[model samples]
Target: MISLIAADEVPQPAYSSGVMLLIAAVAVGALLFLIMKVKLHAFVALVLISLLTAIAAGIPLGDIPAAMAEGFNTTLGSVALLVGFGVMLGRLLEVSGGAQILADTLVTRFGEKRAPLALGVAALLFGIPIFFDAGLVVFLPIILTVARRFGGSVLLYALPAAGAFAAMHAMIPPHPGPVAAAEALKGNIGLTLVVGLPLAVITWYVGSYLVSQFLGKRFHVDVPDVLFGEVNDGNDEDEKAVLRQPSFAVVLMLLLLPFALIASNTVVATLGASGAIDAEAGWAEFLVLIGQTPVALLLTVLASVAVLVRPGRMAEAQSLMDGALGPICAIILITGAGGMFGGVLRASGIGAAMTESLGDLGLPLLLQAFVIATALRVAQGSATVALTTTAGLIAAAAAEANLSDLRLVLLVIAIAAGSTVLSHVNDSGFWLVSRFFQMDEKTTLKTWTVMETTIGLTAFALAAVLWPLG
Candidate 1:
């Protein structure tokens, strides 16, 4: 005879014990050292480490491949479409002269005296819709032009722009890194935006000001020949070649539309869940459906075409599309690989094991999120990798802890802050800044690297303070 029991009373499988947790921690640390110190590609390094983690946990070898496959597919399925669309949209903005228009208008409005602040604002706005590399290339020419005309240190303008762009690229959603983190953590996109935007603003201000003050004194140095050759002095030919700037309204509208849609969807979903909206029959379902993607890319492209494609600019569109793909491809691949890593960790039960162990320590989830993200960022140079990896680890913990949506969103921002800190030789952004601004390694380290670290640290500090309020 069998006895019936309450559904909630059913026994669940036991998690890894404390000893297994310690082993997992050691494995994670070893993986980081091998990748960072030994110089392995993170994709290969993470997979190898994950397999070792499973084996050390006494999981059978035959199951490793299955775990990896699950991890790869799950992450790709969630993010692939959004990434592809984002790339295409960024290409449109670049080709359409939208970024150029915004830069030109800001520089003109601010003049040389205040150009640094203006450039920083332009970058903060422009970077939201475009990739960092694309923004760099699109605007670097202008930075050179401004420096030549104004006689100020290139760092004054360049660092502000780079800081702003990096801040937004790392923190904003609809960009692959933050979006992936948010998805993995099941975070509320609206709250992430609200929390991240202020942090981004503060980061840009502090980073730009410091870069200007410190590096502005070193303006006497010669511009590198490579960048010097590309500088234009605004001749008639140069003026003729200049694309017409897109209207500020059009550009701002395109950039904000997707964010608005996503935010609306999140708000609706939250309200519906809380019974603030009628769930059985209301606008909430539609909002949730539309919010599942970054539909704003489509609107952005259309706005670009409407505002930028005057008679002869069709060729420019094709050129922009071709150019944008090359830089974006690397980020896409890295993000996909990160997804695979996260999946493998989950399938192998490593994420769960790590979470269980960490939970026993009684650390607040917010602090744990930031620390993991920062450690990974410091270990590997990629913010996306750090955000995605941290999100995966946090997801495992969130499942056990039953963390709220608001807290999860805060965790995503905290991870973003971590992934953003400490740019150096290993980071591509460092090279981009060094080359574009004609700065030597020392200057680049002093200005660009420090500025990035400032942005990261500032943003993280803000997130830390806000975590409790949430």
Candidate 2:
């Protein structure tokens, strides 16, 4: 029933299980070694390897292009706009000094003694409408500022804040990782959002905030001077960009708007499904229509711009929105390539191969999702790629496995959590965190790596605990 993934479309494989497995291993190994050792661009490596994987799997050569295109187009159809709007919103907030305002407000509310927690809380709030990389970029100045004034390990503030972004991005919809996974699995996106937000917050608190405070003491890191003095860094421009600082309430409202709309949609759908509301009623139709994640997020972006823009500077706001799309183009394309690779693997019978070997073991569906996602994440270094790929691989099995809708959604969460594990040298995020905090490889491994692993495991554990209840 999956779009573009009919069972009848899958070609009969000529390769033995051992050969198919070998091809799979070689495909993944080549992808990693090229991206890491040979220094190939990730987008190129993913696309090239996907085409090769299709050929090796014995698909007719002419059908290969269609397979890749279906995967790429399907993934981008859901992911591109959410990311586009989200990044635009983030750019506006960052360029307008709203991020600084938000951070300062957080510190004021929490007081200096608990400033680390405050920055983390701010990041958590700011992170809802933002991706990890973009959110961290905006928050870096504030994190550095807090670290400078407070005089302690940068990790004290940085880890919790960064971890908060990571947690939200990994678990929540409109972040692409979980969303693409849900799409591939044909699970309920609205239900995932409704169910996911609470779980994300709980897991972030236990996995990121508490764990961060522990690791903060052990791994002391000095805030780097990199962004402090650079003219183009926007540290100076951002301060004078705004006529007056935006109120914390305004920022908070914008961040929460999308979630509220998405939640309302989920609520209405649940009520209608349970016969609390007439499914055919106009109210139900309206709620479900506006409540779709893309529509909600898009509306949020539009509403934020209206509220956040200085009256005479609509043009500048327009520029910020336009500027936002360019930086994320690479990210969007790479994410599609990941989806393409996953599609190829699916067409090749990797999922069936796995089911044949492991399905008889009676591993809980949630555990299997986590294990597969974690392996792909560690091997490849892209969480979105790992997530989308794993979801595609397991899509057929998920359909045939007799899982409920809610369980399928939770399975997506489990996959997302798995994708968050063990960010090492292979991951760009590892280097991003390391360079930003001025930590060497060893320290980054000790600190950032540990925090990432904790977030993934904790999120997965929480999802597992919730599965039976579902």
Candidate 3:
């Protein structure tokens, strides 16, 4: 197994644990001030703060760059490939009209009476491969169309849909938060998916769906005219004359392909372990290689593109793929920088220093995971940063807990669960919801903010409750 902790030992602290904790607090404060107040680009803020924190924590100046690089590169090794492939696959689905096809089919099948349910279902399917923001935007037109047609609270349709995307983005693979956390903490990618997808669906239903229904009715918000300007209903006469959308079945298959491939790796590896099948068998070995997270995602992207692109349109497809990569470059860099910050914290002996004390506080490992992630998430308002940083901070302590494979995966979800809580002004996602829904601050708080918290708490509760099963 790829251990979550880096190979090189953290140098002994030059200062006592209290001073080390003080330095960590001060450094984090500076990081927040720079990002939230000074409006520094997060990637820049993280890199600068990480370098300074290492020095303050008494890491040798000569070793600082290597330490940061160790975290950055190690995280990127897993993260870059999965994220890169995921976005490309999503772009193919987006540009080829696969998402639209799925949405239309969903609304048509479920009808406007159950439009909220329909949109939520569709969002869950599409959200698997794409980030939260991207999936929400893609579904916005469809959501707006449904809400307008239904002539009721937009929140009814919007909240459920938005919440679904948020749930998957927070917990599932191919979305950066869970993937990066898993990478940093040495959790298995295939296993995360194998377990996470079902966890996501169950919690989302219990939390995001149930809460949105209540809030949607109480809020009584209107659908914004500007968010999806001049959206046409499926009744439009020219619908057949426009671009040919992919079939709903095709979209569904493309979306599920990566999950299936990655899960196969877990299953086959399990059977091989039990001597039911030969681990070194040629067919099993081939399955194992392609079933690796990055490779599986790569194959899924290729398969999706092959199905999505039309004949004689290779250049156009290439251009769309290139466009997909551009927007994600910043996200990828920011994630790696977050890893650098985590790397610095690990190298400073904070994880080792805090392990015994935290364990003795009578806190369960799952609860500790949620609390740490929630603190970082609430303070900074970036789930990705919180997830990666918390993983680094607790990775050693978690390893020492030596929980079962099942429990360890649940802890990963618990951390992700904590990071999902309470989006506010500090969170970019807060603004994204506010502007998109045309809601003022108070309204966004009641609706988007609460729904996010609900989702987080629900997920955490489920993960913690599931811990005893391990």
Candidate 4:
């Protein structure tokens, strides 16, 4: 029957449980050491470790190549297209002035007095369709300008935006992490998004605003010279020309279209099952199928290129594509490698052993998720790694736990929370914040690390509450 192992039971492969666990730990540790200490590319490190794992577990020589190939091809097949299209979409938005338009529109509506709220909204809205790092770089100049004008800490504005981005980036589907988690756990993407949106709002306000308020007061440091280096003095004609432009309503609609379609499809499908709507309608089925995550993202990207690109903006569009693709290449490779790592673990029976060990501990699924995610997050600096690894470990456990769909969704959030905790020297996000804001390691630890922990803990608490209700 080619049965996958359940969480409560360990599969008996050719190797002993102890031997499998030991080999898995060593493989994971080697990958971490190579990546974090030796500065190897995560993709290479993962592939190397996958082979080492196969060897240590005595996986047949012939099967190893097939396993690696299958893992790589399967993951890239599902995700590479969406990621490539998504990168292009984000680039078009950036070059077409869509991001600036959204930022300016929010600032105008909210006024200078509520810039934080505006920044948060901007992050939430724009972040949905773009990578968090891309979103940050695209809008950093405006965020800096707002901070300079407001006479407060830049993080007073920046942190809220970051929080919103983090929440959506981790929690929502179509994003690589959430999408990977949904696929791994076999959960419904639409329901995950429906719950994730509200949770994201709560996390942003509480984690970003409240935490930043205290951190900003305690740090009270000036913006570093590196960050404010030779500010353009407001006379750059080209830069000025791009500001306050683009159609706000059109950009907003484009951003929301995919999400609205997906959400509406889920609602209709659910209600249809309860006899609230006709499930057999051609339009209903079409909407549901089109709203599938991959299709929606593809459609959005195509529509964005058509709507956002002006006739003369080819150079701008090219630049945006270059910029977006440059950063995403690393992410795409790492994510693909992580997928292979998971697949190798499954093939090696490590996932089954880990699930059995956790079941033996009698831990709640939420707590199990938290521990697994937090452990991986501490070991590796990548949240994507933590989320993917934890999801793989818990997939069996979740099924054995017989969790409701809502509880399974909450488990995804819990894994996100655990992955978010304690970002420090090992974490790249810490360094990114430190470099961009020109903070010393210590200050970055105090602000960015704490902010991440706050987001993680807040998300965990919310997940805990929601888990029981589910």
Candidate 5:
């Protein structure tokens, strides 16, 4: 049957555990069909599916909208503010030629022979605050310019740079995937950022950078001239280039500001928990307050305006920040809807049933997180959706597990790793890389697909290894 009696009418769902599990499976299958075959917008599809699933699960008809709103509002409360501030910070850096400055300086330091390495490193630094798509698009011209200058496979320059953004975007907070996962799992955002930063860099090096070297030699694809043809590579004398680039120091400071602030908060909280310091003390409380993730990002955005924006350029700066928010509106809404779906699943008792089933199967929570996330990711695309949905699915189990904050953070990373693997035609990123590099689908699969899998596997392995320690 499509629905049982409402919870108000009947104290319990009419279906047995096996039937409820089947309903959950059908709901997920229906969602995949709606998104993949019907070509529905994810936001609309998620919201529609959430309502249907709620109805099927026997939630009272009058309570359905509030349940949806509760999920949506809870996610947005943690998500929307951070995303808005993060994009604003990213936009400030992008418009002010911060990416160019960082790239130019890194290339100069790393030398021409190691240009690819330099590009990758620069991308790692620049990608911290930006979304994957925005970061990739912003770095495109630089990647192309370097590829043309050195005259080798575009994969050499592109893969590492692209992979850096992918790593940071998938694993780290303030980026929607990790941020939403952290929120859904009730992980500490500060610790997520602190732990994720170094892990992303290490995984990117092992999975992406080294892989690019072999792939570069194997595939000798040329740079595409479609986007920015024959551009001067950061030439100060180019009359057409008007914006004076910010110094490397300014850019570096902006990038590090949030990390520093958030880390301080995490450290103090950790110390207090360990009985090393009085967390309730006024001094410690003050540090913790400033170190809060949203507060730190907000402070970083304000600092960017103060330090990066020159006198009388306030209007221009405002415009740049305004432009950044427009693209991310869809992302924010879709994420909230994903949360709504998760909420419905939890309220419908599917989460408890799945937890019990997984336990009977003897799967570890860490492994369960990765496997479920991977299934969702492969069935649909969009890492953010996979991350949020998986977090929601496991939230009940995770809460009951009563993991420490560290374990929760590690769990978030595991979920992120699962969402990242197996990008193919269904993933927009696969197409983005394909078209940007002018590679055919086959080549994209061999290069982008393989590299993404490696990155995901590497990250998951790291998280799993650390799970016991946490």
Candidate 6:
């Protein structure tokens, strides 16, 4: 969503709309072949193809590197800090046994018969402030332990929790995809979180939880020994940390800390914009500053270390947070590269061409947003890239529509839904789940891919239904 070129600075088209569209198609095709077939790293593939696409689209050679860097830097300016801090919080929670505390309490409250539901509920809460990959990694041991105790397919315990994280990551803020999409589209971050939270829960319950029940019946995947080995076969006490684990109340409070802060800004800013409050008041300005997404998360992280970590274990806590950073470096870079690719498309006038073509097709803008995102997702395999590129493709039309903030957020939801569907071999997350669960490609296709499609369709259905109200 970052604009590399100002409105008046937009260059004249070098080719006809049809030709530019064709060039974009070919660029996407090459990008796919490189990543899915050649097994090139996504970061390398993105940067390479971005350069090539710029050349093919007739961007001046002199401006290409700056264009790429501008796109990359602008996106990272918003994404890296949030993702880094969120991952740090997640690691602190994971190593401190916070995930175990939440799952244990929830399962006890729900009783043994509804253990899967309890795990899902815990994941939904944990996922709000953490990225999908981080939350999933933290919960793997708990899911396996519960599945082993209850005696059923691991799918029963795993799918619901995984789906919850997926739903939140795709639709909610703080995670890079939706965060970047919100920034690109100029949507209200607070409102996107406000509208997206309940929609995600509903989408997960219907598309994921229910569908998981059906899949669990048909696909009986035994718990794998790959990660934990015979340790999972032993007592829960074996895996407990040496330190006294934090209570559920403390863990839940930590998770909700950012939400309370961010929501205050959203509420106050809305009231101020509508002339319901003194917009220029000192208190209002201070609330907005502390409520900034990165600032809120930063405050939460500091509070977590103080409350959750023992005074003597500061070094251990620091080490855990440092470990979290190493894994996310690739994710951050790939996201920045995705922004660069989208920027190139915009700079080359391909985005304008895409806008004109969508208009010629006469499809409603919401439908257009979903379909384009879906196609990009199915082709390239990275949801982040699809969401980023699709936002750029439609940003021109969205700006011209003069829509309200609510409608803009709905468009982001639609785009996210399109990106969420159709995960396959090319997606790293697919491989992560496949390896963790020890499922073959065929089984993964049946379970993960199908569940993803349902989630996407369900989200789009809700967004479409809500479009009129927006």
Best-matching candidate per TM-score: 6
Misplaced by over 4 Å in model 6 are 1-13, 111-202, 208-244, 362-456, 459-470
For candidate 5, write residues 1-470 as lDDT tens digits: 00112212212343676777787778877876786678887678878988998899888899899878866676656556766786677555555666556656666778777988888887888677655654565466567656766688999999999999899888986676787788878888889999999999999999899998889889889887544333333343431133345688887787677767766776687678768999999999998898776788789888888876666767766766777677667656765675566656656666444434454565799999988777656544557766777788788899999999999998998988888888754355665577567776568778998998899899999998898898
For model 2, give the 10-residue run with minimal summed lDDT: 1-10
Candidate 5 vs. true structure, TM-score: 0.61
Candidate 5 residues lying further than 4 Å off, grouped into runs, are 1-14, 111-244, 362-470
| lDDT by residue for model 2 (402-438), tens | 7888898889989989989888644556655765576
- Please give, for residues 118-175, the per-residue lDDT of candidate 3 as tens digits: 7788789867765575556545556765676667788998888888989998898866
Q: Which residue pairs come into collision in candidate 6? A: 1-184
Give me the overall lDDT of model 6.
0.75
Give me candidate 1's TM-score against the actual structure.
0.56
lDDT score, candidate 5: 0.73
lDDT of each: 0.60, 0.72, 0.72, 0.67, 0.73, 0.75
Clashes, model 6: 1
Q: In candidate 6, what are the lDDT values of residues 241-292, reduced to their tens digit? A: 3223678899788867776786677667767876999978999999988877
Query: In candidate 5, how many Å is residue 106 off?
Result: 2.8
Query: What is the number of residue pairs that collide in model 1?
Result: 1
Candidate 5: clashing pairs of residues: none
In model 5, what lDDT does residue 357 have? 49
Each candidate structure's TM-score, on Cα atoms with residue i matched to residue i, is: 0.56, 0.66, 0.64, 0.62, 0.61, 0.67
Worst 10 residues of 5 by lDDT: 1-10
Clashes of each: 1, 0, 0, 0, 0, 1
Candidate with better lDDT, 4 vs 5: 5
- Tell me the deviation in Å of residue 240 in model 4: 12
lDDT of 1: 0.60
- After TM-score superposition, the amount by which residue 8's alpha carbon in candidate 1 deviates from its true location, in angstroms, is 28
